[model samples]
Target chain A: MQDKPFMSSLTTDEVATSLRRKGRWGLGEVLFWLAAAATLFFLPERHLILNEIAIIGLFAVSLDLILGYAGIVSLGHAAFFGVGAYVAGIFAKEMTGDPLTGLAVAGVAAALLGFATSFLVLRGADLTRLMVTLGVALVAGEIANQASWLTGGADGLQGIMMGPLLGMFEFDIFGTTAYAYSLVVLFVLFVVARRIVHSPFGLSLRSIRDNSLRARAVGIPVNRRLVAIYTISAAYAGIAGGLLAQTTQFVSLDVLAFHRSADVLLVLVIGGVGYLYGGLIGAVIFKVLQDILSSMTPQYWQFWIGLILVVLVLAGRERLTERARFLAGRLFGRSAGAPRTAPAREGRP
Target chain B: MTPALETIGLQKRFGGLTATDNVSFRLEKGARHALIGPNGAGKTTFINLLTGVIPPTSGRILLEGADITRLCPELRVQRGLARTFQINQLFPAMTPLETLGLAVSERKGSGRDWWRVFGSDREIVDEVVGIAQRFRLADVLDERTSNLPYGKQRLLEIAVAFACEPRVLLLDEPAAGVPEAERHELLATVAALPRDVSVLLIEHDMDLVFSFAERISVLVNGGLFTEGTVDEIAADPRVRAVYLGESVDE
Candidate 1:
């Protein structure tokens, strides 16, 4: 206890030491990110594969917010993603052609819905929460199908023309804008999410996830925070969906399918939840694998995915999780030279 | 000042079983009171009711002269009511300093910042340090609450709760798992509480109870069995025969 005066008295080293105690992502993250950025730039665009990867990456990262940081497990997050895409699509058809407005409208709409139904998530266990979310997405998807006038129903919306970026920056033929647009979108959201995870609100979510009862007893208002985070995460998903509709002028009913959401979950899990950047990396890795497996043997793609899933589960989620976290840290490690989170507990920093 | 809290006919039932059968008591501001009884005395249930966990079947809970029986837990907390568990309630992965910062933030209404680094809140940092120091948790501020010794965990739990600066605190068996050597520290902390802050402690350790409490209440089964000073309780023949589980003549 005596060390506190000296510890608290010296503000500089405390925060620095605190950050150091949190451990630095260091050189690994920089190299991985730079290399990743270089690869994306150098690699020739082929069949919109790179574009698809960006969309899925963003989707997976959105799921990571709820799954990893908030300890929420959802298999139906794609519902929000799909909803955003549809909103964006409809906006492009009727409203001004600027994609960002559509993105904003879609995000706000999805976030509002996420906030409304979040209470359903706050009370239930992980599995129960997943079911409720999945059901919500399923119902929303059905409604979209039934509302043929607005959503284009089962036929899906076609000829979505996002006039341009801000009605000026025309999308290039090489998809350089699409890739850069998606990349920039992903980068900004990731940073915001990072700030969130490191913020007090973010700490509360982790607290709720780790021990809801304790958090409540300490007056954290657990349920409210849960709902808020869910809403915010859904907003992220909405933005990701918007990015998709923007890059591709058409959006199909398949975007709203349950499989899309399930795939997003797989990305986070494969990457590792809770560890920031795990979902992003997981998205890239999962997309690549999906691409490779589908190309090698299109018919048996599921079989390869299933086999890999088994290995991932057997080798242990913890192992892959650590690897994911390590990779994520390397790619997005920014904790270096930053102030610490909180003073250590017992011996934990 | 008025009593920190008061409960009237706090009747609570789970199905056919009455968990708290017509219990009522008043905790004056600054009073160090102890509720002592044998096991299954409904002590925890009473705390739960006060904390808005389970609604009392037919009762009213008032805090600082305000009717708070219908208030939710968080709302009640906002109105300056706080409590701790019989078992240690802690965010295991977090350090004590982090834990207290959160507790202080919850009190200060800054717990909503989802992007602000908690350590960046200088006031909260100072307050956390202050609370942790008072509870003797400053030494282990960086350690995980779960990894600390059982006694230290209890101390940290109390410290964290204190970060809220609640007007009243309900401690459920603070000395339950703590070692004999460190029980005094726990008792001393409870004894040293501010005179204006009320504390209602539940414990089975009669010696510790007798020392820390200026007033005492005995709970038998699910009802208030008796209420009196420590001397009155120690002198009561029925208390010895019933709750002490010993011959009154002894």
Candidate 2:
């Protein structure tokens, strides 16, 4: 062991360096958000595709809260998504034409559903959670299919008539307004989720995920935290669904489909599950790939997508990124910028 | 006036076998006690029953005179009862700094505050740094728990339990896998614990038990065979015949 006096004196400075903000917004995070905003200015014509990416990004983020942070494997997250879409659709047609009010209604409805059904997740392991979650989405899809009088069944909800966002911006033909709207919603919610995952509550979730038994032994209320995160994630997914419905002025039974749940899970995994930006990056990649491949092949795009996913999985996220950086550095004759997220190496900034 | 922890006729059975057969135990405030027995003598089971990890078949566990027989593990933790595992149960992915920060924050009742930024809690941060220093973990604070040496991991484990600031701490084999060279450091840290927090250590190491425990309880076949001071336990021929002799043979 080293000298006790030197080690004792070194404690405060060393601890501060190590324990300080593990996830504060960096320059890269700021630049990324700014670039996302800049897209509205430059890519006005591609707003429709951008809007889709934004919605999926939000959905992936919602899944990340439970799957990545809290270590809950859910396969029926679309239950809340579908519920939100239907709730928003019904609110617009029957109760209110105001978009914000409808979105709020959708969010609350989905959150209530999440809270009510969260207990099932509390008692089970990964596979059991997956089954229960899948069961919920299945039942929800069945209800939507059978209730023709209320939901329009197979044809989907029609004549949504979403009043202008905040009584100002109309749902336009070019999708500029829709694009901006979803972007803003995604940005705000991302900020909130980002803050949450960096907070003390977020630390507890990580601890619970890493070791539930030890978490409880250390005075953390594991089940309560799980239920809370699950309900919050449901609300987030609900909001994403509401954004989709309002932007498109439509709600299809497909929103509640099992594929929606599985697709979102795939997007999250592609991006990097635990990190917030993983979902965002994953969504953009997934949507852009789907667009290009679907257009080129029109029919066999699934094969291309599956191939890409397999390659990505086989290579692994960190290794692939490192390889990409290494190749870029070698080609450009410039060293890669300090391997992002190596804060300890960089020392106090 | 009340014992820090007391178990009344605690019993546990797994259908055909009674693992802990109506074993009653007690520890006074600030007591340094040890529970020693042969392998599979149900020492872990007894600790589990006491900590509410598993409910006893029938018994009452009183903590500072309040009955906590049916209270959950977390509730027991809140009531100032904490324990370290025989095998360290730490979050493998997290650094010691993160782990200790969490333990400190949770102990101060801020574990559930999702809105508050973790690093901004200066008081909790300071407390965690203090704990890290106390356990000599400041050097490896940034290292992952799983990547740490066995001795450091054991120290971190005890530090985690200590972060809870429990009234009574149950250390289950704190020095089990630590190398001989590091055993002195572990023992010194254990010996330097605050006087207010009563300790009940479960160990197979007689050197540790004999030196540290003021009162020793020798358990045989899930029952308390004897309880006495260090010298008395060493001299007791019945305890020696059943446990100490067998321990030497093994």
Candidate 3:
């Protein structure tokens, strides 16, 4: 018991974080998080926008775990999200309508699916992983299309009667229950992920990304760690999907579409990599830009989104967070020391 | 007594070339053995065979007298056998302390958990710090490993390996890319490791080879050409001609 680190837990890193709060999640990140959270509360009758941002943020953050932390660049991440959504819908329809249970089912089901396909991902490069994962999602969409009685197919499963959450909090027609419910889930997962990222295991994943052969020689088992993280990321993605389904009380083939995965990636890149708050910032930017652009001209809305994405790419998405950190240091009057997280995959090796 | 690490009839072939041919070697419980050879010699291939990186064509590897020819690299590490590489394998994105922490965790046999930040045992953390400090990596504990000086990277790699607390440490050219000035410090660190921890150093630097090793094994072509004490190998006329430079091949 004394030898086991997880068991004998007199935490020093917590103390480190407290004593030196000048690390990577510096003042700038703190402000960005506050501003993002404040948007939900302050927005005037923009609940729909808020809801979309929250869901997409969770999805993107989940993707970022594998992408940024683990170096698994998956292009078909939407499959897990779609699977979660379908699982939630199925659970609500057949079993208990408990949002918690539905979310769990969605996550578990997606995790299982992810686990099964993880082997395919293990062998290939990012391009292969992308094509295979997206292929799975495309196939799944087709399956849902065929299983109209089960999944409601292309038209989507409808006539869902979602009972009160926890049998106490009733859902409103304004989508207040769904929005509030999803937001809480997102917050808890975010905090949990934050803790994970800062942990020793997380540090190893960064190492694996740095140089895998070197990691192996140092006695770090590269493949096993990658698989374990892949499964966990899948579970997170699955839960994200479930949350969407449970909130909307609907599941559709579109949930499994390639666009969803691509969009989640866009959100992650836009917000920032490595920083957990990046998801929220990226999601808000995407959703708001989407809204403002679409309203300007209902036709060719995607054209505007594509143009913004191009601009973001040209501006260097990573620079946004860097500039913010510089600004935060200036404004907060705290000397932000060097970033705690070393850049992932940075050295030309 | 069975050797701490022994390879019997170990053979490795790459396509038409036999890189390692029936190489047999033994390291006692505390043997500071040096495996040395000239360029094109199968010294690295032999190390790989012993470590199970490349499966032998027909041979058996016994760790602490137990057969481990079929075991994978991680499994061997778990069996108290660890190695450093010919090339420094430090994680570029990680500082020495963090890299040490990961090595410590792997040795503890814990699968990675993402949510497990800030609760590692104090003893383990202390041990990690001790290893880093000893390697002179305390200053670069938070700096990215790539940013460290070239010599420091070598030290950091050794520190990461040290965290494993292995019974048999296979160091593949520990001083390969090190500056002459820092080579002594590197040698001193290797010399100071626990007596019970046996070392197999594959070094081309004879100064380091002679300084740290008690007994030396020489590899030539693709086989064990000679095995003897430093004085004997240096004195052997045959070894001098083919390897020890005591005699000219001409």
Q: Which one wins on DockQ?
A: 2
What are the per-residue Cα lDDT tens digits for candidate 1 across B16-45? 989899988899988889998777778888
Could you estimate the TM-score for every candidate? 0.90, 0.95, 0.91
Q: Sort the predicted structures by DockQ, highest score first.
A: 2, 3, 1
Least lDDT summed over 10 consecutive residues: which range in candidate 3 chain B? Answer: B241-250
**lDDT per residue as tens, model 2, A146-186:** 99799989999999898998899998999999999999999
- C-alpha lDDT of residue A50 in model 2: 98
> What's the CA RMSD of model 1 in angstroms?
4.3
Q: Which runs of model 3 end up more than 4 angstroms from their true locations?
A: A1-41, A298-301, A311-315, A335-342, A347-349, B110-115, B246-250
Better of 1 and 3 by DockQ: 3
TM-scores of chain A in all candidate models = 0.86, 0.91, 0.86
Q: What lDDT does candidate 2 reach at residue B182? A: 90
Sorted on TM-score, best first, the list reads 2, 3, 1
Can you rank all candidates by lDDT, best first?
2, 1, 3
Question: How high is the lDDT of residue A142 in model 1?
Answer: 90
Cα lDDT for residue A103, model 3?
Answer: 86
Tens-digit per-residue lDDT, B1-250, candidate 2:
8999999998899898888988888999999999999988899999998889999999889999999999999989989999999988998888888898888888888888887678677788787777777788877888878889889999999999999989999999999989998988899889888889999999998888988999999888888989999999999999899889888855
lDDT of 3 by residue, B46-161 (tens): 87777777788988999998999998877787788888888877776556666777787767755365555533456566666666656766656777777988888888777777
